[model samples]
Target: MNKIFLFISFALISITTQAQEIKWMSFNEAVKAQKKNKKPIFIDVYTAWCGPCKILDKKTFSNPETAKFINDNYNAVKFDAEGNEEIVFNKMTYKNPGYKPERKNSRNAMHEFTGFLKIQGYPSMVVINNKGQIQKTIVGFKTSEELKKEL
Candidate 1:
């Protein structure tokens, strides 16, 4: 009985520890949510080949306080800088017709939205207001504390 109790305790502890997560949505969903709630949008633009992007995902975005703050305050979106996903924002349909699967890990063509935003580098963080206007852009990796200030 004692062994079973210990196992259940450990399982509960693991579940609680894993609950801290950033709720990332698609850009379209974020736009719809913004229309209803008037919350700002936070976009994390990253390519798969960027090392600093991975670090930001693992360290800053995964932090409990950071996740909770973003979840509560902003409509978060994770955008692949080189991906082929279609995004419609501000009466524009953004697509990457030249995206090649072979160049998934290497330097591929940028998504139309990325180009539209004039993102010069990977790991760019964009803050957009509820009115669909760009607020600020932070290029490169930032710690959780730094991101909190941006929030």
Candidate 2:
């Protein structure tokens, strides 16, 4: 009976931990969701080859408290600055016209959306108000506590 109870406890703990995750959506989806729900959009502009960007994802975004806070306050988006996906924002279509598929994992052409945002570095956090205006742009890596405080 004690062993069964211990197993059940562990299972519940695992479920609780898994539930503390931020619901990340695309930029377009967040915009649409904003029209209905009116939540601020938090966009994580990162590149595949950026070391600090990877650390930001693993350390800051993976934290349970940070995830819960963001999930509650904002619509989160993970945007690849060097990716090939076409994004429509502010009534314009943005694309990485020179993107090379062969160099996807390495450095490639910067997406037009990234340029439109005027992002000069990796691991940039772009915060947009519920009314679709940019509130702030935070550059560089930030800890979970720092990110929470920023928001």
Candidate 3:
């Protein structure tokens, strides 16, 4: 019983860690990692209820080719456009205290990153250079090959 339990625990931990490798990370970590790897950072700005976001995660993000390419070339960050999380950029604080959930054009309307990247649609992907400058923002779904060309 003890051996079986240990095996199961290890299996669960492996699965959890595996999922983390595929998902996007935050800004600070991306910055630090870019210094070492010299690859661009990719940010996926999405919304909770965005259907296209789900599709991209499943169809584009989950692909083995996509995984290899992203892991090799970019530090991916996933940010929700409608979220109220406070983000600091270049010594400036971007927050929407009046951001009401599920509302159309409220006081806390959009995240600065979203506006900076000009994300017109959910699942929008923006590539930032090693110096943290905006490279380009790719909107909508992309096949593995389609995305590979951009990198």
Residue 85 lDDT in candidate 2: 81
lDDT of 3 by residue, 23-116 (tens): 5688667777788889888888877777878888888888866886788778888877877767776677777665687573332467666776
lDDT of 2 by residue, 29-48 (tens): 99898888898999999998
> TM-score of each candidate?
0.89, 0.89, 0.77
Deviation in Å, model 2, residue 4 alpha carbon = 9.0
Question: Which regions of candidate 3 deviate over 4 angstroms?
Answer: 1-23, 101-108
What 10-residue stretch in candidate 1 is worst by lDDT?
Answer: 14-23
lDDT of each: 0.91, 0.91, 0.77
Candidate 3 achieves a global lDDT of: 0.77
Off by over 4 Å in 1: 1-15
RMSD of each: 2.0, 2.0, 3.8
* Root mean square deviation (Cα) for candidate 1: 2.0
